[model samples]
Target: MSVQRRKYDPDFKRNAVRLTEDPDRSVQEVATNLGISKDLLYKWRRELRLKEGLAFPGHGKEALTEQEKRIKELEKKLKDAEMERDILKKAVAIFSKAPK
Candidate 1:
């Protein structure tokens, strides 16, 4: 049997992370009140701190900055070019062989 993963909206995640930021509330307390795991709340808070407010892009959502998007595009183009070059090399090797 397989277990299905639960999906939370970006707003919910952000709010949960925000709750963990409260000075008066312990992370465990907030997590219990929110009905989410303490570890998950900590992880979200860590990510939010690291990203400086940009966190939790929901599934299939694009949250990359302009530079990050450009880098991803370039990386993909480079991968495609490398694949084409490899195919061309293989084709050249095959055509250069002698047949009986």
Candidate 2:
């Protein structure tokens, strides 16, 4: 039989995270009392850290700013210019090799 995963209350998670900060009780003890696992406690701590102003990867919102749009446009133009240069070089070679 598959065991059902239990849901923990937000307050319980808060207390569990707080208990981790206490020198007296270890994370495992707090988690056991809260009817959860040490790993879950650690996960909760990570979530708490984010709420406490931690910057986790890919967590920040990105709305393409004006400067960023301009930079992207410029990069595309540069690529187009390179392609044009290559095409011109090929055309020059083809014309130069043709007989009059």
Candidate 3:
């Protein structure tokens, strides 16, 4: 039997991580109160520290890394170029068929 992983909400994770940040409460104590592993709490804190501006992008949305962002940008450019090419092709066909 496979052990199902639990999914925590963004707010819950944020709150739990915030609790770990309190100097008065040790990480182990906070983790026990939140019913999460101490390692998990530490990992979340590390992630929050590293991505202070872009942490927890919410459900159904991916938090892209630098390489992924660059790839997404390039893909958009390619799509725009393809659309322009199609439009120009149609225009050329229309003009060529018109009486000179």
Candidate 4:
């Protein structure tokens, strides 16, 4: 059994992909500057794009972390307070219109 070894400098690949993200730079130019195959550069670029917006490979984490959870709770309380104020205003208006 033989384990095939593939030699690749990931730093160059990462830099090439990062520079390629700039609309002003050409992929061919970045690939050449990074001294890697344009094909590999494109593959890395595609991988980075695909990886975006995903928190992890599997089992997405909660959108609200602990601090965010507290913030969301506070926001809910504020919204409820505003709604209660509106209700109180309507109640006062109704009472003021009633006869003595």
Query: Top TM-score: which candidate number?
Result: 1
In order, the Cα lDDT scores of the candidates are 0.85, 0.77, 0.86, 0.72
Per-residue accuracy of model 1 over 4-24 as CA lDDT, tens digit each: 877878789889887777899
- Candidate 4 residue lDDT tens string, 1-100: 9987545554555666779889998899987886667897777778657654332233334444568789989999999999999999999999899597
Q: TM per model?
A: 0.76, 0.47, 0.61, 0.40
Residue by residue across 1-100, what tens digits does model 2's lDDT show? 9998666556766777989999998999988887778998898798778655332223244335578779989999999999999999999999899596
Ranking by TM-score: 1, 3, 2, 4
Quote the lDDT for 16 in model 4. 66
Give candidate 3 misplaced runs (Cα > 4 Å): 58-61, 65-71, 75-100
Clash pairs (backbone) in predicted model 3: none
Better of 1 and 3 by lDDT: 3
RMSD to the hidden true structure, all candidates: 2.5, 7.6, 6.5, 11.8
Cα lDDT of candidate 4 equals 0.72
For candidate 1, which ten residues in a row score worst on lDDT?
Answer: 53-62
Worst 10 residues of 2 by lDDT: 53-62
The clash number for model 3 is 0
